[model samples]
Target: MKSKSFKRYFILLYPFLMLITLVLVALISNISLNDILMAAAKPLTSPFYRLSFIKEFLIVGLLSVAMNLSLSMGEMNFSLEGIFHMAVFLSALVAIYFANFFIIIVLVPIVLYFLWQVPKKVSRGDGNKLIISSLIFNYLILGAINYLVYTFFSDENISSAVTKDFAFALDMKLGVAIAVASLVAFIIFAVKTSLVTKLKIIKDAPSILTSTGTEIKKEKRAIDLCLTLLTSVAAFLYLFLNYNRFSLQSFTGYGFDAITVTLLARGDFKKLAYPAILITYIRLLSLVMQTEFSFVSSVMYLMQGVLIFISILEARDDRNY
Candidate 1:
């Protein structure tokens, strides 16, 4: 019975199976017998590469969960771009002054609260309206954030847009530990808790997302706020892990990847982690393939799009709606 129950949920693992298929394709795209042998021995030869993969996955996973919460309500958030920059800058600023990780953590919720209010005011109770408003609002906020980063973070030590690292939260060991704990705890709470049912109900009936006044209450509001804060935290954590330098660019590049991870998860929070890992592999593979096999790398993203679409289709459940 236990094995049967477990097997029933095996379909949820489709993202990973797709990921395996992808890995094979990538390896074959520019195949070499020696490279195949190296790939087989990679784990034994260089275990840190595996660690690097896990670290990237956790970073992507946190941001995906943040998006998943809002997506469950049938809403799209583009504020992730601004959130990534602001969370890192503000958190790094606090770290430089106080040298306390807790301070950075505490400040995230406040920053997110302000960000969360932006959409509520701009959106006219419509999902598409919210997306447009978010794009406008986030870029507006991004301008201010870029200016601040360039002015404050870009000093004499930093000739370009990047800068030196800050301590406290910048430790790789600490970041990895936090990532593991976060992945485990988030999965447990999202799947094993009562909130799972509420999320499922919302996923099945996306209409209720905009049915304002009496149709919604603290339940949905609480989840949205939690997601907003989670997105900010994900940004904060990224800065912690890769605090080597700051990017003053309008976008930090992970916003789309985060969205891809969330969409691939397809409302099943339990399966969210796998999609995050899959995206991480695709991204990392693209980086390697870009230099060695430019043509193959160019097609990597298109391949990922096809796979994510198929995986999401498999996970789609349209019963209640």
Candidate 2:
């Protein structure tokens, strides 16, 4: 009986053992275990550490949840990336031209609403159509940004270059205001989910609840929005806090990092916060590793990509026949 019990325990432990072995092999072959642990721990207290990655992670996670929710309802809309980039550009432009902190607080949701609504209406409930339309819209926004920057601020100093001074201003009061507003918005949404319609929707479609119509969904969305707003504010604030602020440059890599963290967390915003920090740490460590052990950094990215791919495949297989 004891032997049988031991065998059963071993069966249960098998997958964990495999995972540990894989991690050990990877570390032994490429990076030192100590270095990897240190790299992972660096985010906890990095001088450049900003809580904004948490916000970014939440935003991306919420967006992912929203997309999943819509898809479960038989609606396919993948225009979030486009909407997100557009929102960022528009917010930055607002900060540059008007410098009204409240404007961002008011405008972001409006922009997201329109971004969400247009394709939904045009597609008329066709998932594939909605996706294609969103893709086109994303390209259009990218083109517009290029044209606008080229036309109005074509001079190298004015156009392509970021004004160090202005960047600093964004990081200070303006950043703080954005963070506060985002937090408020998140709280309101979370409180409002107690309404009957949302509960009914959750009852009818549990999966949709996972994405949109549950108490948790509302909480998650609110958290994500708050996190994103805070991140944006913090990033801008960092510029102001430092006198050596550079030009207003978009960090697409950070955006992609947020997406990766969100994907890794599977849209659980609360759970995602810590992982987002880890991701940020990894990003910083990558810089150091790139200089010391170039190939390892590349391998880390490759491994992350593989993990994401495998996750998607497994999720799809589980969901479908």
Q: Quote each prediction's TM-score.
A: 0.70, 0.57
Q: Which structure among the candidates has the greatest lDDT?
A: 1
RMSD of each: 6.3, 8.1
lDDT of 1 at 309: 48
TM-score of 1: 0.70
RMSD score of candidate 2 (Å): 8.1
> Could you give me the TM-score of model 2 versus the true structure?
0.57
Write model 2 residue lDDT over 127-173, tens digit each, in one string: 45665676567567656755665555334654464431233243434
Give the candidate number with the greatest TM-score.
1
Tens-digit lDDT string for candidate 1 (38-151):
553443356665665655676677778877777676556656666666776777677666677687667777777677668767896655567678767877877887677667
